[model samples]
Target chain A: MVALSPDLTGLRTPALRRFLTPGLVALLVLASLWSLSSGAAGLGPGQLLAALTGDGLSARDEVVLYQIRLPRLAMGIAVGAALAVSGALLQGLFRNPLADPGIVGVGAGAGLGAVLAIVLGGLLPAGVLAVTGSHLVPLAAAFGGWVTTLLLYRIATAGGQTRVTTLLLAGIALAALAGAATGVLVYLADDRQLRDLTFWGMGSLAGATWGKLAAALPLIALVLLMMPFLARALNTLALGEAQAAHMGIDVQRMKRRAILSAAAATGAAVAVSGGIGFVGIVVPHLLRQADGPDHRRLLPRAALLGAALLVLADLLSRSIVAPAELPIGIITALLGAPVFLWILLSQPSAARG
Target chain B: MLQIDDLKVTLGGRDILHGISLQVRPGEVVAICGPNGAGKSTLLRAALGEVPAQGRVTLNGQDLRQGKPQALARLRAVLPQDTQAAFPFTVAEIVAMGQDAGDFAPEPGLVRRALAEVGLDHLADASIQTLSGGERQRAHLARALAQVWQPVGPQGARWLFLDEPVASLDLGHQLFVMRLMRRYADAGGGVVAVMHDLNLTAMFADRIAFVIGGRIAACGPPDAVLDPGLLERAYGCRIAMNTAPASGPWFVPQAAQAG
Candidate 1:
């Protein structure tokens, strides 16, 4: 039967969305537990629990838990949440379902920044090197993304109106330019720098450490903190920029903040994890299909679902080749494409042709 | 009162509106009628501050140019000519957006009541994409109504500025909406609409403004402004004038229980 008043049916879906918070959190917990256990140095659930409480732990197990597995899990959750939430924000801001930070030039720009720092570190002064210490690459990557987004915004936005076509075209051109610049830097790099670049370029969760996680976490946290306030504004934005403005949303300010948040999230994630793809696109798209597209529901939920999906993917990445690892990017593209295609085909008027 | 004084707009090296001046008071419906390319929508956009224009435009004694959007929103709402939802939001969710302006709590039940007023209560749960063009227009109208739901709030008379509000609607829905406009004016709100149908304007509007080449060629009540000779000259087409309806109210939406 057709649901007769939105009073009855409209509120129901959002209520169900809110009710899903705990369930998604639980899924994240399960994924995290499974990830903490399944690896090169596999531990059972009991031992996993024992490793946590520091009760009857072996020195080697302790080393693995604190240094390897824990940091990896934390980084997976952080980067996953960051990528996913950035995807949700870009989709909302552009009012296009297909929009993603990776699809745009933001990630590519960050990648160039990481390469620049890696290849040019010798030219920096000793004092500056001392100041940057271990954070040179991630900081450069975040700054690069921020600059690219601003440049893209300048190129594609005219008089407070974003030209989606221009944005898409400019993104293609910008990504190509960044890729070329990265190539030149790769050509410039010495042997040791080439090794760092190669390992980083492959996009693995294998080398996650507390120091790398700490460098990226603060920026991602800022993006996550700014998201909730954007929820209501982004929901109204789906009605068009002018309509959103009519609803008293400060369209200019909201647009700036949204771009900033997405750039920071994408930049920080790319800096630490290299180029994990499809999490941003697939997570929000799947959630919107399962529930609805209200950004209030989509944003935080995307974070949790993204984290869980990545953790599970990472688990599969290492275990499928046990004692060796496949790049996480390959796994996501492999997994996400089929699920995304299934969703598209299942919709009754999928093409609406 | 909403005032536009000597307002002018230029776009892409062409003038759209030139020193157009008008005033709308509470408890009245004003219609702007003109042929295509006569700058009717441009005038409306200038008033809403959607396009930057020179000269003075004010609502309730506050200058629209300097007035904060949040403050302006509480006093007036606009229904754009066309809108497409970027996502699959429900009709009720679309209307609920109108319930709040910037920093105010939504008026409880306004979304339901607005949907009912628009004869869309049954389809409130439906996806906005599933709606026909006419239905979509009405859904947006319902949202516009919910924006300034109370005819007169603490800030004096609330206002709705609609652009071709009935352009996509069917005959029955058009009359229903015209009557709704009449009733809204009767309850002390003000409305300014860019109108296409002259008969509906004559039937419902308290004042009429005829735009031609970026200026008001004629302005007054329907009896004075809708002259056949003036309309014929302005439109460059032969015109006919009559009042009687050959007609039908067709559908009353009895469940809605309103005019």
Candidate 2:
């Protein structure tokens, strides 16, 4: 269906795009507050605001707010945004709407690496294996993510070009391999290591700290800053490699940069949050439906929508069981899958392929 | 302004184009006509550097051997057959992509004018994916038009390489695209198009090249190159040619009677 043109004169000069940004920003603000205030401590909105502003709160409340909820909320937002942006980039690169970092094995690869680190930690000295103190696990996870990305890239490319079907197939194969590796590590873990691995695999923001946030923030910021400039190039590329080359895109260079950025962002997110699923795949599709498929707009909108979705998911994960918490990954899968199915079913048959 | 010398292309251990040579001056429309698998598309791809080939291609006397991608893109634009609206770009955005590599800033008015030339201006804001095949072809032509550059040093003429530019188009759109190419040539641009429709080639091509089995069998004006002998030899099944009142010859394929 054709989009109706917005009136471009007078007050609507910036048009529908202006309205969407503020609306999404407001939703994100509300979701962030809900994430912070709706947990076990259950501070009211006013107290939450007071704790945030350092206005009127006791020492215990201050510690809980600053040391716990704030970091968790920040991690949720950053990881969610990173995953969504990476998904948008991959979808553009593959020219397939179904593409996501998780589907491409980046998340599973990172998860496998982190599980391996945990399993191997028992063999090392206690001083070297301190889980929270050492950056070794994240480093290993990032390496695993990048290696898997390279493998997928090579398999997908043939005759100096990439094909979407080949890329998807390669991604599925690697994802299965990583999953099997993760399963073996889980099977072999001791009681304590198994507990740690299970909790991490369930996808928590509970481990968020200033140090972890510091590690992830710069990478996310760099990707976000660079990805919008590539929107026009990606749009051209969707026409196919031949046309994109004719348009002077240097299609191979563009694909390399896009894939590298996607891997880095996805790896960083997995390192911080531990295998959060569905946000990457669903957020971009939802935003594309709402705002149409201009990646310039879609990228930023997906970032915001993703952050909001994760914060909302986190809220439900904490509150649905009251004293007991559901795993955030379970919550996202339950919610995101139905929405994704609805979108797919709603599209006409011609548009689906 | 554009010359190809002894061009040869090999792909997948198979030689697809063998020692083909031709030239097109400014304001000339050269149509390469051939049957299926006769290397017409291969020749156009070779010219655009989309496929590897052994040859010398000179644009206004500048050697295009090992030409940098950016330089080639600035000097020529290609429209291949079987274009799909694979993305959701607006028509205007797709057209603007043609100017992405060049030094010249694209004028929006030029985009509108190009779309108008193909009678697609009203759909400029529409999503490209929603267009029909004919409309999408016109949009591609508009994109090529936007890429047309006047060399700053006065050394080269812009060339458009089209492979089956009008295949699968309705009669009107077929005529429209060919006429647009003719007008582009008349404006001092060079055009080398691969066409399957011999009638259209006869009507508009300044010269015709008939290719058979990866080789150019004949190259000359339509009247000289499209005679019965070449037609029967290249196609293996053809009958008669009729001269049109204003255009040129029209070939009718005859069914062989069972013995």
Candidate 3:
């Protein structure tokens, strides 16, 4: 619905956008290195460098370097990047700065799905449990996310139009529904199952292993690679659905793809890392403030920033309480809550509009 | 050419558009004028397929339903009544959305030309959220212009459907946009405009179609259709027809005279 003007001919260069993305990527790389080196095991840059260079190390140090810390770092990066990019997608798709996996119920849905698998695993037939062993939680979690997202999308959309107000309302309803279901699952669980549920709800990278990483990496990578394709559609969507259709975007198709991808990425992240909070909402909003609202730049920058922020948070979580590790979700919420308030306070009028 | 025949639209189980028929030819500006709630905007939207309707619409002899949205977009463009942007996209990025629907990237020069046509060239990098309502309306017009910037089909003519485009504009901008529509028509394009201002419609429209009670009550040249009795009957108020030396035909309400 853009109008023509007599003097609207100049092309915008967006100079800062060029530098901001690469800078974030570089920062993420440095953060990754720092995370790889620092830990409770007293590993330093020397050990990290030696490990990377394939230099020989003492057996115990080698186990700590290769097994304990490396997979955790990889899991942190994957989960962080996935959550952030998923947040960016949902925000763009919903046209709201506050939209995130957790707020929209995808996280709670995944959590419920994983909880079900944990508490109800013994009831399934031997064959189904055997084949789905170790994989059951993630698969169930992904299915949970998919169903909830599909329901949310359906509820928010009608007659080929998606309203942000309706979406947020539906998200709230769905999140509450998922939370209640998870609570019911918790009540049914025994002591061991209860401990697992509690730990998973708090979120951590401490349980990360190469096997979990391998299980989640493929889904996360698929969503990440799909971002480039989704970026253009999401950008056009900012103009509203009717105008997007007028410009030749298949608005329905774009909505379907974006919702599914966000659900998948969020599901995988929650499946492996429990309930890490704020990465999705925080990173994307900050990047948009710095880089403008072009999804081409926003999505990738969100991915990198999400990766870096999670890695840095993981480092803090491990070191903050020393031998007794703090939940990563706790750190993210503390960090994110302030930023969320700042965003809300800064644009008091935007929410009203 | 754009054609609609016997179109009927029902929304929420209420009939919005009764059986209606009309045709728009190239190199002409056709204004669909009516009183408020006369289904003026609904008529335009139904033809654009934004809402489901029972009708037959054809563009250049091709049924609209048979064509893909992308293909139809290349042949015709629409400027809706509301142009509110949700995100704080830069003006350039917002305008660039017109090109994103097609298979290939639009040349940056075309986008600039569209913006320049709407008189918003200097604000290309500015955020759309910062623009005033009138400026945003112009920006949206520029986007619509950028969509079918060139007439590429076999007919070598494009169609523009605008719904009360100048409803939010000042007097100067109202004429500016009306003149732009006139220019687009002069360049062998067709424009279907939903207008509330009768004087402006008489000045720019090659033909006028008066919608009353969800139907085309009158359709013809400005002089022929700007009849006092027909307008009075349509508006449920007294109307007077007048001729201006410079503006051709105009309408004046006779409510004061009756009182």
Candidate 4:
């Protein structure tokens, strides 16, 4: 029972429908080119093509193009794709368009782990330190994400069914808990440690490397590949859980897989990229508003848009404050917050939920 | 046939249903009517295995809890009171979701036929989120109809559990849904509805089960269960009962008589 709103026609106008798949891919290519050209080392298309073909290029150009920009670009694509797809999966799971990775404590959980590693890494055993070495922070962050996800999911689910509302509320409470823990860890950090913590909290791809990408790529790819199988199930889930079950979806199994996949994707992305916020929420929300909420179209398109947005944002982070990069997270937040407010203002009913 | 035997449900550590028992047979519509918070919806949920409960619910002599979700989906469909599909799915797309749980592959014509039966054939391309509440309810009914479109299953008889299916509809659409359910029953399917409108229940239901305090206080044919005393006791209000010239029985709440 709802009072009729004035906008009786749907939100999918022709303008909104213009960027489904092909449009997004085309934009992604242009953005990627722009990113490749504008880095600290200005490697134009000729140099990029030379690097690609293993043609005539100086060793410095080779290092910048292959070691630095390429890895960062690759990491951006993986992290962006992961976060956006995870958000779409979550929104579908919750049966609410506003659901995001942060709603489920993944971002906070990863932040807490990173802070702990930064503040407490010296106190850890030598064998553990030796084994992880420079990779200790990302490893801890990923593990923290996994633990928090499992805990939140366990607390919210009873028997086989996951309560979407409960998961959301629990996530909020868990995020607060993780935040307090992160704050305590930050308080204990030295000046240099605090600086590292702040930069990591804000998020960056500055730490990108072939090794980190290699480690995280499999997890991100597996989660993305697993998502299409869930498209129909998630579509049915748009109706409430009971109807989903009544329609013959193993509602419990679907919920489990969705949560796990989202967690895995978010964990991998956060581990590699630090705290890149808003891509998850902003990309999917914008896509759903533009196109209809068909997960079949929504998920893949969100992935493409998310990858492009993050890649472009990463470029801005480096170029906006040249020689001293702004954190990618800050760029995304600056861009995303206004769009989020506009969406809420326009769709007041969706905002209430 | 669908049978509920000694089904007890407790929510938030409070008993909501106490050993409720009922049977729904093919070719008949059984209406469960009760006052607010009388466990009418809870009974329907328990019957559909959407909620946890004690005791046994069986469809065609097979225990409902033991059946796989896919297997049970083929045998029955449920239409809940809240038809809030959050996504902006087209009516045709929403209707097609009915086939997701079925054993057989999707039949495109079934979606169209189900939409037509609910008088929403013209709005098949419209977004479900843009439709009025009543229209959404009809679309959900159409979804349920499309789910059990075969009308008969390899098992015994297909069952439909509707919780206030027509609560949001106008008079014409309400009758349209009722007739559709009637025809569904006529086609050898069983339907159990949680109802509120006494007149519609009297007109449409083959049998009435008056629920009170989480139990079936009375159940029988329309005339047999239409007594004002039973309704008054169940609803805690005075009720005026009347028989229509053409229809069978109708009832409305009366102002409290001075003690």
DockQ of each: 0.46, 0.40, 0.52, 0.63
For candidate 3, the per-residue lDDT at A134 reads 77
lDDT of 3 by residue, A234-293 (tens): 887776777677777778788888887888788889989997888988998778777677
Model 1, A1-353: lDDT tens digits are 12321212344465676667788899999999988877767566788888678677778877887899989999999989998998898888877665667767888988898889889977999999998877778778877887788888788766544555677788788899999999999999999999999978878777799999988888899998998889988998888777787788888889889988888888888888997887888999878766778888789999999999899889889888878888899999997776545543443342221
Higher-TM-score candidate of 1 and 4: 1
Q: List model 3 lDDT by residue over B1-259, tens digit each.
A: 8889999999899988998999888888999999898899999888877878999989887676446777887888888887767667778777777755533254758778878888899988888877888889889888888777764445568888899989889999999999999999888888999999999999999999999878888999888888887877777777777788999888777656332
Give per-model TM-scores.
Answer: 0.91, 0.89, 0.93, 0.88
Error of 3 at B226 (Å): 1.3
Question: What is the model-wide C-alpha lDDT for candidate 4?
Answer: 0.81
- State the lDDT of candidate 4 residue by residue for A199-238, as single tens digits: 5665789988998788677778878788788898899888
| CAPRI docking class of candidate 2 | acceptable
Each model's C-alpha lDDT? 0.82, 0.78, 0.82, 0.81
Better of 1 and 3 by DockQ: 3
DockQ of predicted candidate 1: 0.46
Give interface RMSD for all predictions.
3.1, 3.8, 4.1, 1.7
Candidate 4 interface RMSD after superposing interface residues: 1.7
